[model samples]
Target: MNRRVLVPAAVLLSSLSFPLTITGASVALPDLTGDLNASPTAAQWVVTGYNLCFAAFLAFGGSLADLLGRRRLYAVGVSAFLLGSAWCAVAGDVGGLVAARLVAGVGAAIATATGQSSLASAFDGAARARVFGALGTVLGIGLAFGPTVSGFLVDLAGWRAVFWVPAVLAGLALLLCPALPPGRGSGQRVDWAGGALFTFGLGALIWVFVEAPVLGVAHPAVLAVVVAAVAGVAGFVRVERRAAAPMFDLALLGDRAFLGYALVAAAMMGLLVPLLVYLPSYFIDVVGVDPARAGLWMLVLTVPSVLLPGVGAALAKRSPRLLSTGAVLLASVGVVGLVGIGPDGAPWPALLLTGVGVGLTTGVVDGLALSSVPADRVGAAAGLFNTARLTAETVALAAAGSALTLLGGGQPDSGFTDALRVVVVVLGCAGVAAGLGAHALLRRVGR
Candidate 1:
């Protein structure tokens, strides 16, 4: 294969593997819970642990790519991920699995932080858009297929089979490693203190979000974590201001276009990520669908995601503001349409619409964010953008899980339905806000 074809193929494979695990694991979670005798909270951690670690390490991973060569770190990340997947397959308990997932999440962080930057470095202008579109297409396929594949594996082999599949795919990615372009280290000093502070601070904050629903927000443990989070984050900002080279360029936050794109991406994930995490369970628990069938049903969401990225890229070229605003509004409509979904309701319509909205907006926002910054800082920009998006995903999952627990009271089924409704409403409102915000920001930029 030519270098152009070979590098993007490798990058996409490496990048798509993590998301496959994310959605696939969600499908496998119920089985894992039963086999491992996990409590609800513990089972939730199987997903949360991955998101938490991935989010925490993203910026650092990107910085590492800039400082240590993208291809080198990409290989390291894939190798670590393969090891983690193997560990998860053999793990005997929920705690062990969650721990293994944390390792895998670190690998995911490194791969994700570098994947787009590498592409940005290799391609420019229209080619960049096409590459991004292709990436989006791959992302859609991975997400679309993940649950169905996991469902079949679980039925035929077991939950462990899910981990094995990704491990195998990652191993293949390793073979293509030589295709990746060589990058010299930037030779800049990394702000270790700032990185540590930000990591701990974000960890503490996520802990509050994850634990607060179980432990009341007013509980002493929660209160203490909140204090630590505030202190750590505040200290991180202070440290960054003084550091010779900060992990994140705080100055980027001032760019209206960048900020707007970041917010839209964050909001999109806030709704979509949790839905992907929880929807499988809903199909099995509430609608009485078999795992395999439920997986097929999820295609309602994944199909549009697969098909729309190119269209989104085209629209973005014409008018990003219109692309973003229209996409968000469409997403809000889709979410709103989901408000009263019940055992008797048809899931495909609402899910397909939401997927279209999310899919379109995601492609455009991704391209916009990459274009918003200077080419040299692509790694840092990718890290910052993804960090925001994944952090929102983590928080959304925690909040949604909490709502299901608290509001469901004694009737677990009913409570879950209620929680889904609440989440849909909130996300719908957020989508509307994002749409309006994008219009305003783009208008200002145009002026």
Candidate 2:
């Protein structure tokens, strides 16, 4: 096999490490708490802090990749993640754990922001699409199996094993960074004000959500968070509109193709990842299953991860445009399945539909998001894409948390009806929008 072909493979393997770390850590949370003597509320911050940093910095991380060069930044990112993982392994308390998670999140953001951009640079036409499909499989596998993976490691060796794995993987990726492209920024200012506003706003919003279940909605902390997330997001948008060489070129919005593509991403990512995140929660918290057993029942979701990409790949090869549109619509159908299921039921079939929906959407989203971008702007596009999806995810998580609080939390069979209703309605709307978006992209691209 050609060494040139092997290069992208190497880059991808390195990229996989960060996402694995994310999922692994979440599953290990129960164990982490006992060792560190953390409160349930505080232990949740280990995940929240990573999310806070990751969501805020994604767009900026892309800018850094553009300004510095993907390879150099990749090395920096992977190395930082490794160090942070080690820091997490040895952290003495909640404060220290949160700090390590924050750092780890920054490093992970770099990987998330640049991985697709790097691949686009490495391949073209059909090959680029194929690479993304494979990337999707890696993503699906990592996400779907995170709890299981973390559960295994945590049970066998300990939760610390989860931290150890990423450190080693990141270290290896750092060693292989030399083969990537040299830096190619377009001489733009870094948009610090925009970054700060985004960071502060999102951070506040997340603080509100993660804390809300523990701190009642009436609590000052919750109120302040709600207020700040709104204000910060608005200020960031205003600043971005004024910035010279904005961190995210909102001008991409003017390109109807980019706009349509991004909205689809926002909705799909916003809905899909969180649905998966909370699925196990639904099983354990609602269905009254064992935590370990609840993870195995997720086999419904995990099995699709192994097989669906190949099916999606075949569809894309035949008609990338319509297939992406159609795949998006399938998510709506899945949402309906969830909404229609009874509170008296196990939701097994509904969850299976959700898995299929996720399978259909992931590959299609990957294709449309990357394929629609002009090659010259691949890095910028990737960065912007990551920002949009992360923003969507942040919103989804916040909404899910808020909705559950309002609905009176307990079993998916009981409390999740309203929550699932919200998920279905919003996701259904998102699906329609994404289908039309793909059609628009196809028309604009003259595919």
The most accurate candidate by TM-score is 1
> Model-by-model lDDT, in order?
0.80, 0.69
Query: lDDT tens string, model 2, 1-447?
Result: 464565576566766776677667656665566678876556656766776678888787777776777777777777777888889988888789889989998888876666656776878889886776677767767777766766667667877888888788777777666766655765555778988898898888777776777778899878877888899989989998988777876766777666666776676666565565555555555555545665577667556756676676676677666556666666656655676644343456766765675575565655556666677766567667777777777767656655554564523456566675666666667667766766776664433
lDDT of 2 at 289: 55
User: Per model, how many backbone clashes are there?
Assistant: 1, 2
Deviation from native of the Cα of residue 223 in model 2, angstroms: 4.3
lDDT of 1 by residue, 111-164 (tens): 776766778788889998789768877777887788887778877898899898
Q: What is the TM-score of each candidate against the true structure?
A: 0.91, 0.80
| Full-model lDDT, candidate 2 | 0.69
Candidate 1 collision pairs: 408-415
What TM-score should be assigned to candidate 2? 0.80
Highest lDDT: give the candidate number. 1
Which portions of model 2 miss their true places by more than 4 Å?
Answer: 1-6, 33-40, 114-134, 179-188, 212-225, 282-292, 313-329, 332-345, 373-378, 402-447
